[model samples]
Target: MRFLSSLLLAALIVEQVLGEYGMAHFSDWGNSKGKDYCIFFNSQWARLPQDLSKATRLQTYDLTSSVLCSPSDVPEGGFPNSIPMVMRGNCTFYEKVRLAQINGAKGLLIVSKDRLTPPSGNKSQYEEIGIPVALLSYKDMLDISKTFGEKRQVAMYAPNEPVVDYNMVLIFLMAVGTVALGGYWAGSRDIKKRYMKHKRDDGAEKQDEETVDVTPIMICVFVVMCCSMLVLLYFFYDQLVYMTIATFCLASAVSLYSCLWPFVRRIPFGKCRIPENNLPYCHKRPQVRMLILSAFCIGVSVTWGVFRNEDQWAWILQDALGIAFCLYMLKTIRLPTFKACTLLLVVLFVYDVFFVFITPLLTKSGESIMVEVAAGPSDSSTHEKLPMVLKVPRLNSSPLVLCDRPFSLLGFGDILVPGLLVAYCHRFDILMQTSQIYFLACTIGYGIGLLITFVALTLMQMGQPALLYLVPCTLLTSLAVALWRKELPLFWTGSGFVPPPIIMEQINCTQTPGPSTDEPPSNPEPATSETNNQREDPTPATQEEVPHLTDASNT
Candidate 1:
């Protein structure tokens, strides 16, 4: 199920990249207003034209440069030309566009250098070009050339209406639902198998000792990290995003190695001992291939994050990779119990609500804390940049690609908080020797919660604390299911809330002893029956008994 989810996530990433980079079609040409084809051109910093559709009728004209610079070119009219012009040349984009603008052209179209690749040039050079401009692929340029050669009149009109792609939305929803169902089923099956095995082994094996208490240390570390991250997010968002991309790339590469460690160990490496117990442990000198792959991923991430302008494919890849790493960590780290999960969710729920909603009210600006930070380098005057959030591009049928618009976003907290509960439920299922239905329920509930969040966001057209919906859905649904199965009492007393070993020992010491085979000696002994019973039953003791046990063993 995890594998399936990973694959689906990859597909979604690819779709986002393609949708953002892919070209919109010139569906038809007519005098009447209908669809105005959207085009992205000019400098990286340039904004889309707002009034392209306002023009009633547009005439097309083939363009040529008067100056010769490259082979297979002809010199033609230069300045004082009228009408929109299409030019095919190897000259720099700024030079050609400048010349066309001076010649009184209403619009400009540059023929691409190759059939598949779009024309490459510095879009930011000629910001003052007061005309609509577009780059045509080689094939498109040729088709337009043929149309002009046949003396056919070319006409263009602005789009009258925009449409929504319901099909795409439905597909995305279906994919998410499938992942939820599949994960639930798989977890349930595995839990049942484990439960049967545990039942067979129950009487023969001793229960494990209670785990150590690391709560204090964990809390301290979490608080420190959170404080540091918040500081960075507020002040150095862009730099932080770049660093995060690089870090996630490196981390994901390492995680990928860990996931494939089993297969990796099987590969023959002469005279080197593979550590079976400590998998994914690097040798004194790691394999060249591993180092190279890691370097490559890091390089790509850094390069993309730093250099790509207005090209959101890089953001999609980085965000998806980060998500994959987080999902992997969630699967790997087992949470201790249901109580722990509940406590975590409760704390995070409040944390999320405060950061998202209350922070604005507290601050003088009355702006959402997260939204202010997520506004990248372009939006902020500080010139800082960061990709701290994951965004999924929303697809619509409108010819105008709203790439610049805000996308569907999930904060890091939204994922990590609920994921901890899901992981805990998995561990709890194993500890109780029960079907994994609890984990499955929590996962599905999380998905449902996210769906609700999306619906609310759509209706309200505002930012929401995802945990507001997620926490209740996951906690209540899982709790209700546990209650229905008569597991609530067990959860409270047993695996869900096991007392410390010291307390357990103390309780045992105070209780009356049961019947034992060893009889009291026919001599003066300890006055208490508790001592006699303890001697007879010979049950294992807590850490407090370690010193006495050592002395007895030495003697």
Candidate 2:
């Protein structure tokens, strides 16, 4: 997952820069409605001129320097007092049309202000700017000039219609999502490998403790800076707000996942280490690939953050702390420390899919409700306001592309799985066969958390402060716990040693001594060299244990 993440980061950088630059420099379409090509003309038969009358017709042409060579070409510009040169200005067609109408002109005639190659197809450059405007092909303008001398009378009627483009938002969101998934998959793989090694070494074994030489603190600084810059961009960059937000959200999600997953078992911090005993040990090969991949993820995250802002140099310091914590969690997770990290990854994936796609779609669709109060006139002079109940959209269609409408794939059930996982983790060591009752409690508790997070984010997006929504979310977590009371004690007790199935079996059978007067062992031993030598030339069966889980998780 780590190597793949690096490849993905490289791809993300290339894809985004190329797409943005290419579209900006080469694509004819931009956010500028003032460009003649973006306009559309609508005229009736009565308004059509005698020579080239057409009704409800759509024609296209190129607008560039080559087509705007002379003033005589425009029928309206042919008047002796009138002159037509490319009129260059910065404003949308809507603004320009209003300006032209206010100046008492029948319509505005626009030609290319910049030199460029002609566009292809039946596309016409001339468009009716929203009020009786007329579009002209260069050829038409020239013909009008030759037949009627310098000027000809023309009229237009434009409307207040506006056009919207969501391409940028969609592109940015996709890029962010891809990068996030890459980071998570990569980071999780590394954690998984470490986990397997820890599991393998739990038995009788003695080995030298590996020295901690790497400076994870430095890497954390890099990642934190990246996250801080992304947050700033999302808040400050108005035009690219969607892109910035998407990037920030995805990066944060990945970072949290990377930092948390390894500790899914939640072993105490600063306690994990190689154990030593008389029994033989078998340590699987260290996952070099996962380590490299993790390093790459850290690098990409920091680099991206740095490039976004530099004065944020102070912000970079945050990554160092984050890196330290990530490394600690990474190391601890390798042992059968806690299931919390695993559960965290699962939770993050849940949040990612829903937050990025579902929630947005729901808000857009209006299936989610809001409350509004309005006063009606109170007397003969004023009516009384109606009772407020709920504010819902009349239709389910959302303007945003969040809910893959018509394809409606995910739903309330999807949210339940992760909740069940969390419940199961908390209920560790508990044995209950009552599926119906257990499932109902799980569903209700999970549903509440899901709903609370959804509402909190929605309110936050709509300008509600963190405190306002956070208070409610705290209650929601508390509720999930309260409703699922049957599982708590077992969860706490089960933490003694929740190893992998194989390791748990070995511990159960061997009757190992309890850690110093009832305390659990600080760390399990890694495989001894003697075991490695015995297994060195063993059949592929032994080799199978080497790379399966880590390799698969990374991919």
How many backbone collisions does model 2 have?
Answer: 54
Q: What does the lDDT come to for candidate 1? A: 0.48
TM-score of each: 0.52, 0.27
lDDT of 2 by residue, 44-116 (tens): 2113332112212221222223233233323442323221222323443344334444434443454422221
- Model 1 vs. true fold: TM: 0.52
Error of 2 at 91 (Å): 7.1
Candidate 2: where are CA atoms >4 Å away? 1-86, 90-95, 103-191, 198-555
Top TM-score model? 1
Q: lDDT per residue, candidate 1, 1-555, as tens digits? A: 233223222211111111112222332243333222223353232233334444324445554333222322323554233334444554655566566666665555555443222223433554566654555555555555554342222333223222334433543353343334333332333334433443322222222211222143454455445545654565576556555545545555544444344344355553233343433534334454444445655565556556534445665564555554544444443334456556656765675567667777765545545545544422344343344345555555544443233244455456655665665565456555467777778888988887787666655545666778889998898788889888875553224323457866676655534346276444334435656666566544423332210021221
> Which 10 consecutive residues of model 2 have the lowest summed lDDT?
15-24
